[model samples]
Target: MKHPRLFLHVQEPALAAQLLQSAVVKRFIVVKSSDAAPWSEQLLQQSCDLAFIQADQHSEADYQQLLSSNILAEMDFIFVSDGNPEPWLDKLMRSGAGYHFRQPLDMVCILDTLQDFYQQLSSTQQQVKANNSMLDQFGLLVGSSRSMLKLYRTLRKVAVTEANILIVGESGAGKELVANTVHLASYRAEQPFIAINCGALSPELVDSELFGHTKGAFTGALRDHQGVFAQAEGGTLFLDEVTEMPIEQQVKLLRVLESGEYRPVGSDKCRQANVRIVAATNRDPQQAISDGLLREDLYFRLAQFPVVVPPLRDRNDDIVGLAQHFLAYRNAQEQQQKQLSTATLQLIAEHRWPGNVRELKHAVERAYILADKMIEPDHLLLEMALADTTETELNEVPAGVPLEQLEKAAILNTLEQNAGNKTDSAQQLGISVKTLYNKLEKYQQTEP
Candidate 1:
């Protein structure tokens, strides 16, 4: 998140200079006002989180006018003065003046107060979620839960607009599917839909992969390669795990969004883009910005419409229905009427699916394989918590369990936890992505 903005009405030069140099004050966006400019006029113009006004310095009429300013309703006010504010405390509190303080200020307590004020602001912002709306199906999504219905309702309105969309959700909550739904439900339904995982690409290749490269652009440029934008012209482009994109690459993306134009690498020729941009991240957008994983400016440009997909835990009511849907597809392939046991259904309802829908689908697949007539809870691996599945398996291994088998299982489980994000999987395993890729290839070759 961007730093909380403070409207610091500085009257004393020494305190202003001290505040500017202090480490405590550097945490905020401080906007100083010292001249005789009306506080109400200035407050009306800029968006501020907190207003520190010298209430006693002005006349009673000026104080009353400041309190009457409509902007104060949206802002938290801390009235400052050298005199006692006891007489005006009741009236000040009624007008949204949350705090009052005398001169010889305690800067130490100020930081703690700011933290509390920030929390209040954060709580208000989180009050508007999609769970209050309604719908049963939209594109590839299938769920009867309130959040799923709300998501469907949100997507319907979002798809009509040409503005960019940002989808935020936990891993395996089907953000890409939501992006596809946005495309399919929009006027661009018949157009190409291109999807790429930002985390899956290396830093050096991001530019070439995104904007295309002309033949002989670099040493390994065998032929001209068309990028996602060119391939997805007049369509939709889904960027998954966008927070994992390098900070430098984010600048290029911001430029494209602003201008709707880009030049292929090594070619001076510029191209206009007709593609709709849709980005997704498993992390909170505000936290990602504060952590420097995502750019603030780019975030505002892309998050014109943000759709948050509900995690499986929040939509547990739909778990059985989704499992049956997956099983039906698998059963069709096997040409058999396979079914889940009552115990398996009970376990599915009770267990917390930390990895969300992807983990649930994988569990269903495993159950299908292990059971001939009826899939049981033992086959689902729901006995242990989803987060502990890998650790439990590792700890309970028999004496003769092969190291290669254990290693493969750990790698596969980690990959599932990350929703098949190879870069993240590699990082978690403390191995290079090249090694991870090699092992995956070996697993494919050796599998019976």
Candidate 2:
């Protein structure tokens, strides 16, 4: 999930600095505004999840304009005051305000307020998922849920444009499939579509891999090789888990995006790039920027159009259809046909599917291999009931436990459950393997 963006319009420099230093503030992507520039302009450009406005400093006209604006209709607002409540409070009573905080702010209270805000926001998002007619498949993508249909509509609109795109979703939500759909739908369909996993490559080799290298560029460079950018010229380059890109490589990529030209690792001459970029990441893009994992400039450049793929659990209605599709595809490949029983289909739908669509595909394939003719519930080889119970157990925690500690425990437990396989654990956790490795590294440093 991407971190929520909060706009800070506080006028007092000292108070702004104090809030900026708070640990809880780090959890959000904050956009701080200067007193000189109009905060409304910032609000217009960025879709903020929350806003912290100083009620005392702003004029009545400013408050009235804000109240009339559509920004208040969508995002949550929290009013900040140094002392007693202002008389302007009467006008904002009708606004969908979240909370009010007075000066000498209690960090604990602020943290608690944010936790509740996020919980409410999550619930609201789930409820707002669009409802549409079912679809078994769209291009190569699967799922008939409302979310899938909405995504298809978005793809149709975005594919026609030459604009760069950013695909955000949990692991195994088929981000690659979405990228493929975009490439096929675009004007560059005749050109090659090259896909690269940014997280899987070594940091030292990233530059060479993306921009090509001359012969003897490095110790092992025996021959000249074309990189992804050159190979994908006049086509589309899909960058998966782009947030895992090395910081230095990010600078190079930013230059390419800005100027449409790049130099090879060893060469002085620069080559022009005609390829389109379609990047994907399992982590929240805004959070990645806030955490210093991704460059802010690069994020703004790539995310010209952002499409978020819905997870399998959120599309429960499509589980059976997807399972059957996988089973049929498997049978076609091996020349052995099988059918799933009604009870087995029910069992598949009931499962939480923590690993999303990829997990479901694997489970279905396993059942197809194990079964002779009719696939039963046990043949599916999925622990539906136990997993459902475990899901609940995982969500609950004892009081006074810090959020970071719980997150670490979840990561460690998931890693152990996967037998220390970083890839599997990351998939189950809906994050990238690189992110999992980073967390492990942090834990290692902190261990006493």
Which clashing pairs does model 1 show? none
Q: Can you give the lDDT of residue 267 in candidate 1?
A: 96
lDDT of 2: 0.74
lDDT digits (tens) for residues 150-242 of candidate 2: 566467556767889999988667888899899998889999999887887788899888999999888999998899999999999999889
Q: Which candidate is the best by TM-score?
A: 1
Off by over 4 Å in 2: 1-135, 384-448
Error of 2 at 375 (Å): 1.4
The TM-score obtained by model 2 is 0.59
TM-score of each model, paired residue for residue: 0.62, 0.59
Q: Which run of 10 residues does model 2 get worst, by summed lDDT? A: 124-133
Clashes of 1: 0
Off by over 4 Å in 1: 1-136, 383-412, 416-424, 427-448
